[model samples]
Target: MKKRLWVIYGMLTLATATWGSAFIAGKFAVQSFEPATVAFLRFFGAAILLFPLMWVMEKDRKKPTLKDHGLFVLLGLTGIALYNICFFLATKHAPVIKSSLFIASNPVLIVLLSGLFLKEKITRNSIIGMAIALTGVVFIITEGHILTLFQYGFEPIDFVLLGAVVSWAIYSVVGKVVLKKFSSVESTTYAVAYGTLFLLPFALAETSWLDVQEASLTTWAAIAHMSIFVTVVSFVMYYNGIKEVGAAKASIFINVMPVSAVIMATIFLGETFTLAHGIGAGFVLTGVYAGTNPNLFKRKLKGNIVKNKTA
Candidate 1:
């Protein structure tokens, strides 16, 4: 049981890392491909890759119902198609860092959605950890000047970013319930396939998609990375993590994204690591640890009390 939990945590960590890197690769891809085209091709590629694996894994599992298929379609719509549309559109309109900050509301939204829709219990530790983790993210993004958030106020694009937050929350919470009926591979594979179909019209309609054929090799490589690692590998692992741990607990791990992104930038892009990065990373890691292991702080406090008595 302990080993399985560690494996799940490792999977979630890998998923978060890939997703974090997607920000960099996606920025590169969109320089050539249209937003819809990028999303379509990415998920279309993912479906192709995941389908065979899903078929093999699900061979012995129960067959899906018509209703199950319907739910998978809905999952594709909200989680993949709609979420990417809003995400691409939002970042197009807003500054990327500001857009990321707005989208970071997803973890909190997921916790609330899980509580309301899934009847998941919200612990005090989770709430406190969520707040701390968010504070760290804001600190990192704002570069220790968090007041910038208030100065900017809300922009129109903020709503679109919020749509992404809500869309992802719905995906995580609703997908959890769906996982009860289908294996993670089945659920993610069908969702990606249908999401590709949903993205087809939008991709076709974009005149910018013509540029895709003329894209440089680097751009094509970025798209491939997004498709294979970010979409196929990361999302499957994310879904499996959600299945192993409840959505609310798993969702908090999303906070690792900005930290990973910054670290990746330092390693690959020659970006300098700042003091705010250290503090923010500390808070984010500590908060996630507390939130996911709710009893951790309590156990430590008890241990200290025992030590004091012995002293």
Candidate 2:
């Protein structure tokens, strides 16, 4: 049991590293490509790579039922296509930190949504952890700006990030249902491929493909990394981790992203990493750890079991 637990944590660390470097790659992407174009290219690249893998994973399963097929199509559209669209749009419009904070909201959301759809019980510990994490998120972004609360104006791009968060939350939660019908790899592959199909017109409409020839070698390298490492490997690892570790625990790794982003940005983009950021990140991590720990899950289950006995 301890060995399996360590493997899950290792997956979390690796997922964070992949996603963290993506911030640096994205910083490069926007230099030569529009956010839309970058997103379109990444999805297209992932679709091409993942489809064959999907076939291999699905070769043994019988034909999918009508309901399962429908779910797959929905997964493609919501989880794959729309998530990337909103994320890229958000990134283009807002600071990466702000965009990432909104994306980080997904962990708590998984807890909430799990309660709603999966009948998971929410116990005191879960509530406490959720509160801690949400508060930490506020702290990270506001940087003790509690006093200036009323003066804050909403950024349009942040909404895009919010949309991304909601979309991904739906995707992760819905995967539970789809997993009954398909292997993790199969489901991920199909959803991503079909999702790429959802965004095909946008890529085709990108008049800037003509400009692809004029980009610097560095831009090409960054785009390649985004396509392969961030898009393909990251998504595969996430689904596998969710299967091995459970969605509730897997989502905590999302909080670890900003750390990697900071390091990569400092080294590659010359972005500053301040003490305030570190303090805020500490809060975020604390919240994530509390929220995802199996101890919290066990406590919640115990509470529910006791409530049933009392009833």
Candidate 3:
């Protein structure tokens, strides 16, 4: 049992690490292909793999209803298409490390949205954590000069990254509904197919077949990494982790993503880590921990009280 648990943990860790490396891959991919095209290519490749895998794993699952199809469309539009478009556009404009940090604050947004739309109970910890995480995001956006945010305003890339966060949060919230009808693998496969279909016209409008052919090997390699490692492999592993350990525990592994992205950005892309990055990352990670695991502090407090009573 211990060994099996360790294997699940390892899969989650590796999954998040690959997701971190996606920022680097996305940065390279956007340099050659437009954002829509880049997103399309990534999912296009992923859909090819996911369709077959979903068939093999979930073939016996019940089919989707019309309402479920609507939900799948929503998931595709929000999570896969819009999110990736904003993601690649942000990577094109901002430093990958900064972009990763902004994305790291996503859980805060997810918590807030879940409370609002899903009617989930909003705990005090969630409110506090959201504030802290938003503050950290602002600090990073302004490069530690929070005052300048009022004086100047947000950069275009900031909006782009925020859009990515918002879209993904919506996807996650809606996914809670979709998960009732379909397995994670099945839903994801359907969403990817729809997203790729949605992205097709925009990708075609952005570039021709010749441009795709002319893209450099590095660009192709990046797309392939995102498709194979980040999308297919990491997502499957993450869903598996959720299945094994539950969502709250599985989500803790996401903290590894930004750290890994920062490190990989430094090593591979030659991006420098600033003082602002360090402080913002600390705040973001802390807030994420607090928000996602609202019961953790209570558990610790309860344990301490029991111990004191025994003494």
Please give, for residues 108-227, the per-residue lDDT of candidate 1 as tens digits: 999999999899889988888888888888877887777777777677787888888888889898899999988888889988988899999998888464586688887888888988
Q: Candidates' TM-scores?
A: 0.94, 0.83, 0.78
Model 1 pairs in collision: none
Model 2's alpha-carbon lDDT is: 0.73
Q: Which ranking of candidates, highest TM-score first?
A: 1, 2, 3
Question: Local distance difference test, per candidate?
Answer: 0.86, 0.73, 0.77
Evaluate residue 154 in candidate 1 and report its C-alpha lDDT on the 0 to 100 scale: 72
Writing each residue's lDDT as its tens digit, candidate 3 over 213-311 gives 789999999999999999888877876665565443454566667666776888998988889878876776676566555576799999999999999
Give the Cα-based TM-score of candidate 2 against the true structure: 0.83
Model 2: ten consecutive residues of lowest lDDT: 143-152
**Which wins on TM-score, candidate 2 or candidate 3?**
2
290 in model 2: Cα distance from truth in Å?
2.6
